[model samples]
Target: MRAILAPLWNNAYLLMTLTCLFWAGNSVIGRAARDLVPPVGLAFWRWVLAFTLLIGVAWPYLKRDREILLKQWRWVVALGALGVGAFNTLLYSGLQYTTAINALLMQSAQPPLIMLMAFFLFRDRTGPVQIVGVLLSLVGVLVIVAGGDIDVLIHLRLNPGDAIILGAMLLWVLYSVLLRFRPPVHPLSFLAATFGIAILFITPFYVMELMAGRRIVPVAESFATIAYVGIFPSLLAYAFFNRGVELLGPGRAGVFLNLMPVFGSLLAIALLGERFTTAHAVGIGLIGIGLLLTRKA
Candidate 1:
């Protein structure tokens, strides 16, 4: 088994797959516990915990890279704000009002959004195959959103949650595009810096959440949710995703995100007792094919 898995162990795609799986879990947890913890509080405490865990691990590198980090502070702050602060807070907020299925479908729009942003901002060229892959993956998401009925979309339904999630997706796309400017620092240091800035940026909003009388109920489940998101998604998933983006570049890395809904659906079946339907199978198939096409070109 070790021999068989050896080659795949170091594969960037596998790392990205793990990242998406953890993130899918994050979404599920966020949605499941939406009533237990307010979104801003959840988002705030998640990074607070992640930052606490990361700082010690990253301190040595951070000390060594202090000058470079200071020199590039603005870029780091932007990364933290968009990728960490806004993206997650918005996502959690959206989950309060939307189904996970709807949110993940909105998120599937990230690839093409990233592609278009790259083209305009960086003059990065996407090949025809990549475009086709993106479209196919998008179609798969549409299938989920429309509940396998094309006519459902004709009603042009609009909801606050969908809009919020779409906005979150836009923040993530911008964050992914901005990753090209990441300074050459240790991943730990980078994560530490971003987590710190993200926490700082979200502090006001978190205060407002408290001021508005929305507080996190200190329950075992709430703490469990925060702890899981802190360790897995915030720390490990970000580490894995950063490595994947470094190895494969953001565009290719974005392709693996198509797996999120697949993982989300499976998780729903296992945890929430949601039915596994034909639409899910077909959507998963299309996403798999789309990933393969992404690999082709």
Candidate 2:
């Protein structure tokens, strides 16, 4: 198993692709389970379970990197608060009132936001080709989001849920930009620290949720949702995404986020029995072209 997985670990594109895939599934599951689980509670338990699962493997690294983690405590805490704690909580909460289509469309804004934030924060510059690629991919996303009808966008209305999702997206951009300052430690150590800290950051909100009587439903589907989220999106996706950013830098790594809506559309078709349409094919093609152009640039 180690031999098979070892080679893939060094492949940044593969790692980012898998990260988006897991995250896309997370959105679908979060939306589906909104009524079954409270948003804050889901975020809290997801990180708690992730920390529990990872700490065993990360213990040695955590001990070895204790001093470095301490010196970089601010970065760790900020990342935990924004990325793991706030982002998922806001996303799930938004999904409760917004359509998945709106959420995915809003999510498509991350790549450019990441690039812009990177530039302002670190003087990271993007080439003209890269900018074009980003815009092209964005058009593709809009194609998918609008179901190939421009009127869909024109007729769209802003709701409170959309505002919440937009806030989540902005928080994620800040997190991605800050990843450049991550502590120079083993990836496991960093992930474990962040996951643990995120659990702490989310505790108050989770308690408030419970106090409000918004507890998770005690059903097999709810349990399954929690388990899947804990393992895949919380544990593996963050691990993969962080490594991808380490390898590719935030700007390049951010482009992979554009793949989420593509995967989300395909997943919807497969899981929800939605029909595959011409718009899907065209949007996917444009996104592919954009990715290739960005890679070359």
Candidate 3:
């Protein structure tokens, strides 16, 4: 029994699972608050809160690594802009027009897209297994888009949110690849720096959203959503994910991302009373198989 449960006790597995669970909750929150809070406002405030809390906790390490952090400012800014700012802002924006289940299902494309991007940018090679995995995952995503009916492909209609979410997923893949260049600081320090940078990048867009008449009202629901996002997805999830990356390496760590759609869809069903259809199960199953195959790929 001890041997059977050994993998569950590992930090990588625990961290990765927790990270996915937090992100799954994020999808629910984002979708729930889509009408109450402006996307840019939510993105900005989430990072502001995350940065303030992180800097308070991690200031010692950040101060010690000030020189190294400055030297790596470019990578930090790029990572912050893509991962923390753009990806989340886009995700929240898309949630305005999509279900949490659909948004997360679209995100299932990330690993395969990362493989392609890595291949193009870094000349990383993919095996036949990876190619097969990519194909299977792509089919699953299409099934989700088609809503269990192949005839929907005749017109191939897509929600506007799906396109936006695709962009969000790609930004996250780029951010993941770019993490290799981050300075060797404590994970807390790294998160603090990125959160600050992300806040800086998002401020302008948030202002624009305000100027465009999408002002965020001060309401309990909005603040509650922001508070949840700031604490869970922005802070703890990032910390857990970075630690998991450290423990398992990016390739292996990424395989656990398959759990996001599963958890997200379940939460959506349980909390939002969304339907669980055969299409969802079939799509999730194929995506899970694809992600598992990537281990050998």
In angstroms, the error of model 3 at 92 is 1.5
lDDT of 2 by residue, 182-276 (tens): 99999999999999888998899888889998988999999999999999998999999999999888888899899999999999999999999
TM-score, one value per model: 0.94, 0.98, 0.84
Error of 3 at 106 (Å): 2.9
By TM-score, the best candidate is 2
Clashing pairs in model 2, backbone N/Cα/C closer than 3 A: none
155-252, model 1: which lDDT tens digit per residue?
A: 75558988988999999998888898888998888999999999999999999989999998988999999999999999989988888888877888
What is the descending TM-score order?
A: 2, 1, 3
Supply candidate 1's per-residue lDDT for 100. 62
Question: Candidate 1's error at 198, in angstroms?
Answer: 0.6
lDDT of 3 by residue, 85-195 (tens): 999999999888875546755676666666666678787667788678667766776665566887766764468988898889888888876676778987888999888
After TM-score superposition, what is the CA distance of residue 17 in candidate 2 from its true location, in Å?
A: 0.7
RMSD of each: 2.5, 0.9, 3.9
Comparing 1 and 3 on lDDT, the stronger one: 1
Give the runs in model 2 whose Cα sits over 4 Å from its true position: none
